[model samples]
Structure formats: C-alpha cells, structure tokens
Target: MTDTPSDPLKTTPLHARHLAHGARMVPFGGWDMPVEYSGITDEHMAVRTRVGLFDVSHMGQLELAGPDALAAVQHVSSNDASRLKVGQIHYSALMSPEGTFVDDLLVYRMADEHFLLVVNAGNIPADFDYIRSQVAGFADVDLVDSSARYALVALQGPAAARVLQPLTGADLSGLKYYWFTHGEVAGIRGMISRTGYTGEDGFEIFVPPADADRLWLALLEAGAGEGIVPAGLGARDTLRLEAGMRLHGNDIDRGTTPVEADLSWIVGWHKDAFLGREVVLRQREEGTARRLVGFEMVDRGIARHGYPVLVDAAPVGIVTSGTQTPYLKKAIGMAYVPTGAAEPGQTISIDVRGRPLRATVVPLPFYKRSRS
Candidate 1:
C-alpha cells in the first residue's frame, strides 16, 4: 500500500480560479488547495449572513452500483441502508473491524441499485482499498472511483436557494434537507444534493470536470448582487467548528471509537452485523472510557489542537480541534475528556502555550442561524 505522503498531490479543476481570487494556497491531505481568501473571519461571516461559494473538489466521490450494492454498503457502514430511498442522503460512519472510524461520509442513494459515497480527501485511497477488499465476495457489486472526473461546488447560506434556483430547471423547493435531484446547470448535467458541512441551507452540486470553471464563474456572476463571497478551507474550518461539526482526522481517528467520540447515534445497532458490531455493542453496554465535549475558553488564550486538558491539576484528556470562532468572537474547541468531566458548565483548564487557560464546558453548536 502507498503511504499518504508518498502519493502525488492532487489539484482541483478550479485551482486557477482560487489563485485569481487571491486565495492563500496550502498543502492539505496531499492536495494543493486554498486555505483562505480575503480572511477567515470575513469569509465565515459572509456565509452566515448572506451566501458563500466553496470549491470542494478535493473530496472523493465514488459510485457504487450493481445488484448487491445496497447489501455491500449496509455491511460496510454503521447506518441502516435499508431505509434510504432514491434521491435521499444519510450521514454515516465507516467503521474498522475494531469499531474505530475508517472515515465519516455522506451516502446518497441515487437510485434503487446505485449510490454515491462522498468521503474525506485524505482518506480516499485508503477508503477505496478497504471498501474494495470487503466487497470481494459480493460478486454482483461494482465500485468505481469517480473523484478525478467530477468537481463539487457548494453554494451555502440563507440566500443560497435563491441564487441556485434560477440556474436549474429542477424544483429545488421540494428537495428537502438530505435529499437530492438531478439537474442541469449552464447546460451541464449534474447531481444536486441539499447537504452542506457548514450549518446552513445549501446545495452541493457534482458536475463534470470540464464544466467546473464555467459553473463556478456563473454562480459568482449570478450571486454577485447578493453579497456572495468565495470562501476557503480556513473559513470552512471556523464555520464547521462554530456549528459543532466534526473534522475527520482531528475529531476522530483510527484510535477513537464512535461511541467515545459522541457519534454513537450514527451507529445502527438494530441492523444486521456490520464490520465492528461486537466492539460497538460492547462499548455501548459497558459505556465508553472517554467522551467528546465542547468547551469555551474563559481566559484570554486560543486553545489549539493537541493541547492538554486538566481536571484538578491532573491531565485527563486532550483537545482535538479548536479555533477562535469568527462568529462568536471567542476561543472554542472540542476535546475527548473522561465522561465524568464532560458535563456542561464544568470547569476545565487547557494548557495553552505554557499557560493554563480556564474554560467551561458548553453545549454544542456555539452558533446557530435561522433556517432559510
């Protein structure tokens, strides 16, 4: 198997547009991509208040189709696949045999016998290999890695619907959350999913790589009067953090189980056996050793990833993801602490740059916007 570092870096079809918009490019998950445009705070607020566009072509998009497609996905994921209908989508976690996370992904049931799995960019090759290996015995199933041929653009915020409705013939109003429909944008056939990572009403459009630049430029031109800004990964991070969303590598890893990461809700225990059923069931019955929780810094310091969490002056846990929230104007973070110390309002100390910063456990979703 090839290591992540040894693999050549990938570039999206919209790479030139990002550079034109003055995006600060950085290497992420073996991809040369933009980290920020304008500024993280400004771009983050634009999405919350108006609308913002994101080029997320770095994410992996794979198609699973065949007679045994449903069964294959059901066996690989913790979510119940039997409930999904055509044009519906569900958020689920892919578990290792030991019940730890392989990655968290969105599964879109495009048809009765076809599905699309949107996975994190860094985990694409590993995820593809793992899924392929598991489905070797399922002769009727076929898995195709389509990440290279498509580009995904996300139009997000309160005004997102208005900007996208005029571009497509599809009746987007009837396309409820977690649902999708096939549509045409600028004469290019595409799939539109009413899903987003940031907490907002939005649509994720999957179009051919050849039409990527055209659609991106058209969206900008259409939404130019509506305060739409081109956002980058830096702003995306702050937005998801404030919305209490999880980042794969930071908030979850191979060493952490879903139950311990406060993601047990994604596990469908009532369904038939999956890859990690025994371990998850055991964790559920006996309870997890640690739990993920949200906290807000009371002292003046930014709590960052890998910072030590202290209770009673003793190290107990470590912060996984954190940032100075652009929306809240405060330092907030998520960490894995002992269940006993995960209560909301509990006092904890985070060791920040050699100084202990006081913080209080807070309920998730530090920022909430009115649904459009």
Candidate 2:
C-alpha cells in the first residue's frame, strides 16, 4: 500500500479501460491504480500460466542525449552505462552520495549518445532532480522528462510470445531477453522490450500516450483466446515477490545500501567512481553487519512488512516484504538480519501481530520457471 500524497491522485492513460474491466482501484505511488481486476489470485495465475496485461504508465521515463550523455548516466548510476550496447537494457541503481538507494531503474541504450531511463513512479521528482544535479557538471548532455508522453504496458506470461507475435512484424523470437527494438506493435510504433518484473517471458511495450488505449484493446482482443487478462498492482506485487525481485520502496530504500540489501552485484566496482562507490567499496572490504535473506514460514501465520524478526527471542530485524503467494501457495518473505545469522536453514521467528511464528531462511526466488 502506498502513502496518499498531498497532491491529488494521478490517473494513468488507461484509467477508463481499467474501470471498464471492473478493477478495484487503490492508491499507489500517488496514482489511483488498479489493485485487482477479476481477483488478485486469478490475475496472478493468468500471468504465471498464460498471459496478463498491465498498465504501468506510472513509471517515469527520462531521456538523455548529447555527446556527454554516456558520461552523465555513468555518473549518477551505479551500473556501467558504457557496457550497454545499443538496443540493450540493463538494470541499475541510482544512489545517494552516502551509498543508499535513490531508486532502482532500467537504463536503455537507444543510441551511442542517447539513452532512456525508466525509474520508479514515486521517486520521479527526486530522481529527476538527482540526475539533473549530476548532469549539471557536464556541458553537452540534454535531459528531458518524457514520462507523461508515453504509456508502458507489460504483456507477461509463459504464453506471452504466442499472444503478441502475430500483432507485430518484429521477430519476437529474435529479440533476446534484456534487449529492445523500435517497431510497430499492434500497428503502433513503439519500443518493444523483452523485459518484465513478473519473472515470466514477456514484453514491455512503450507506446505514445494517445495510442495506449488502442494498443491495449488490440492486445486484449488478439490474446483473448490465449487466456490473457488484465492484471493490477496486487498481482504484480505477489508475482515479483515470488520471483525474488525486490520492490524499490519495500525490499530496498534510501535507508538501505546495496551491500546490506545483497545487491552489490549491481554496483560496477570496476567502473570509474560512480556515486556511492566509495561507501560500497568500504562495505565490500569490511563486509556488512546485516544482510537480506529469503525465508518461508514454518508456522501457520502470514508474515507482513515491518513485523519484527527474532533471533534467539531477541529482535534482530524486521520483515521488508512478505505474502502468501498464489502460485507458490506458501508463506514467504524477505528480511534483513545479522550477517552471522543470514545463512540458509537458520531458524528464526517472526513477530506477527505480537505472536512469534517460526520461519526458516531459504534461497531467494521461491519459484523459478522451467526454461524449456
């Protein structure tokens, strides 16, 4: 659940389409988004077994271009932007000087001197300000916030390719994962990417806002026979949780560093000093006091965020993310605990509603799809 902002709720381009599908609207990142349609469980299952469409237009899109675009991106982001080839996408983190997450984002290399950054909805203003500050030192880079101009729709599931292939001339099979190509999808020119947060084979199509509803309706009509359905934030959260994909505000935040969050892999230690690299290097050399771990409930109760985690009956940390996953059918959660106690198979107790429930540390990504 997102905190209600002081500003009035913003609606996505597909707001009317969501309502027409009988969606349950809720506040998310200051936007009135669909939490569920049909039902969370049903939508979750659809994405896992078949296909599901999601209106993720609330995500922010920032465009960077000019001779110094590469230098500008490499400065604000932890990952090496120089490593990304054109038409490729890389997951990266933007951090504060103190080494805490500003937001996790996707860096899309559209051209040698052009890039598109997709950042979390809630952090749009902050992220934009942060990036602008970094780019100010460079003379040649030009930045543009094109978030409102585009609508992002994620078509995710095992059958996603089959459902989407016929509508676009782009060779869906030829497009490798983590790559995108500009093409006409459903007769609308857009950037189609083989990326998704649901841990399924899928595509994230970025289309003009005016063409959003038309492309949405077209995809639905074409995919109806393939069991495609519209999914909402509720199912999205559960799906990502099951995939062990961290949610920005929950699993990671400004209070947590990449090292403590077990995401040091995203930091390009070899690259020239990016923001937060010094602190990250120190953490790497000294090691973190606490580490994030995945766990499953050994007891009956469902673990929720902020619930205290106990080690030998003493509070060690609190749960960051937890839920009863529809596809996994298990109570799973992620938490930050002392590094010494972060090993798999370590028995811990979670304080759920003042009662301690037993749980065990387990490997992340409670569920993995069969590649074959």
Q: Output the number of the TM-score-best candidate.
A: 2
lDDT of each residue in 179-218, candidate 2, tens digit only: 9998998899999999999999999999999999999999
Show the colliding residue pairs in model 1: none
Off by over 4 Å in 1: 1-8
lDDT of 1 by residue, 166-248 (tens): 89999989999999999897678999899998898899999999899999998998899899999999988999999888899
Clashes of 2: 0
For every model shown, what is its TM-score relative to the native structure?
Answer: 0.97, 0.98
For every candidate in turn, the CA RMSD to the true structure comes to 1.4, 1.3
- Please provide the root mean square deviation of candidate 1 (C-alpha atoms, Å): 1.4
